[model samples]
Target: MPALKINVHFGGGAELLFDKIKKREVELPAVDKYLPECEKKGWTIRELLVWIKENLLRERPELFLQGESVRPGILVLINDTDWELYGELDYELQPSDTITFISTLHGG
Candidate 1:
């Protein structure tokens, strides 16, 4: 199975949850390998979030995740376009695509 390579970015305080790392290039295994229960052939943002939580997130999972999606106030962009434009969590991921997460919430 071929791996899919994609870029991941965190910003607007979202990076804090990722150990202050602003960017990462991740190589995901075959969709069936990581998401055996999924009926789809391609990887979706929903599955990607699970992978992120397991592989990249170091702490405070609640701050970044809510169920299978991101918490409120977190803006998700795929390939520079809003994820909502691509069906949000159901959007299929493509190789070399860039996925970015920016938090709009801030402490006073």
Candidate 2:
């Protein structure tokens, strides 16, 4: 299987949780890309969130995750579109796609 390369970005205080790194280009393993549990669902943002927690998050993960998704007040964008428009967590990932996480929870 070929590797799936994609870009991930964090902003709006989300970077604080990722060691202040805002952009990352990662190549996710193609084999069993979505079967971390049991069912065969292609890689989605939901799974990607878990993957990020395990692989990318550097600190204060609780600030980024709530349950299986991003905490409330955070916005997620996939391929320049709102994730909610594309089924939110169920949106299957594609090669070279760009995923962005921006936290709306902030203080002045």
Cand. 2 Cα-lDDT = 0.84
lDDT of 1 at 101: 99
**TM-score for each predicted model, relative to the true structure:** 0.96, 0.89
Error of 2 at 67 (Å): 0.4
lDDT of 2 at 39: 65
Task: Please give, for residues 1-108, the per-residue lDDT of candidate 2 as tens digits.
Answer: 456788999998899988899999987776374454536435778778888998899898788899999999889999879988999988888888999999999787
The collision pairs in model 1 are: none
lDDT of 1 by residue, 1-108 (tens): 468999999999999988999999999999888888877888889989999999999889999999889999999999999998999988989989999999999999
lDDT agreement of model 1 with the native = 0.93
Clashes of each: 0, 0
Model 1 CA lDDT for position 41 = 87
Q: Candidate 1: where is the Cα deviation over 4 Å?
A: none
Cα TM-score of candidate 1: 0.96
Residue 92 miss distance in model 2 (angstroms): 0.3
| lDDT scores in order | 0.93, 0.84
